[model samples]
Target: AQRVTQPEKLLSVFKGAPVELKCNYSYSGSPELFWYVQYSRQRLQLLLRHISRESIKGFTADLNKGETSFHLKKPFAQEEDSAMYYCAPPFYGGATNKLIFGTGTLLAVQP
Candidate 1:
């Protein structure tokens, strides 16, 4: 079965501390992986995709094909970075495309 797993439901850390949110997936074929974040009272936005290899808000994620993992990381987390992060993958059904999200991890950055 194809599935995305976020092992952490909540992560709390002080400002400037390093943060890591683990994500793992199981799929037979190549699948597009992404991270989506939603801040307080804000809409969800795409944070990064495995193919992009770009950092957003000082956060980066590297896809490890050998481990089937895509863990999000930030060297120095900020209070403003507190948000709910989700691991997503594109799901194709018939002729339509949809996103399958794992259980989100809520990051709480304390001052």
Candidate 2:
């Protein structure tokens, strides 16, 4: 079973606070990991890729094969960064290239 699960439906926090977005996946074979973020009234964009090992908007994610998890974390939250975060696994071998996303985590930043 290839599935992506995001336990939290929503995550709200004050500005400047640390945020951790949990993600778990189940797959038989090796899968590619990605973090997609959509700001308020904005289109979805790629936040980071596990293979690249890079951080975007002060957010970073590490793929844990042992635990089958890819959690997104940020040291501090920003009001402007408030958006919907989705963890996705892209289809390999260029097979229509669909991204299997979790339900999604709505991050609210309070002033």
Candidate 3:
């Protein structure tokens, strides 16, 4: 079973429009969440963490324990923001801690 789930495979929005990427997680303990972003032909980079309570490049997410969700939101979408976003949380089940990432959501910012 996947520890994280990204409901939308692709979220399309026009320039200047708001965007939201939905994510849901299943875990027994309090899990810190991270959002990863991958731009065209670039390596995946850490976009933000829920614990920081800060926005990165106009994106922000709050960890909701009750709902087990960490939804990424941006007030305005830019064409440069088009990329793949992932919801990842560390998996402590094994001897080595690893990130368990969702399938990922593609954000398409259209002009």
Candidate number with greatest TM-score: 1
lDDT of 1 by residue, 1-111 (tens): 779999999999999999999999997788789999999999999999989899988999998889999999999999999999999988888998688899999999999
Q: Which run of 10 residues does model 2 get worst, by summed lDDT?
A: 90-99
> Model 3: which residue pairs collide?
none
- Candidate 2, position 80, lDDT: 89
The TM-score values for the models, in the order shown, are 0.95, 0.93, 0.93
For each candidate, what is the lDDT?
0.94, 0.91, 0.93
* Candidate 2 lDDT over residue span 13-39, tens digit each: 999999999999998777789999998
Which lDDT value does model 1 have at 42? 96
Name the regions of candidate 3 deviating beyond 4 angstroms: 93-96
Candidate 3, residues 1-111, lDDT tens digits: the string is 547999999999999999999999998888889999999999999999998899999999989899999999999999999999999997776687689999999999999
RMSD of each: 1.0, 1.3, 1.4
TM-score of 1: 0.95
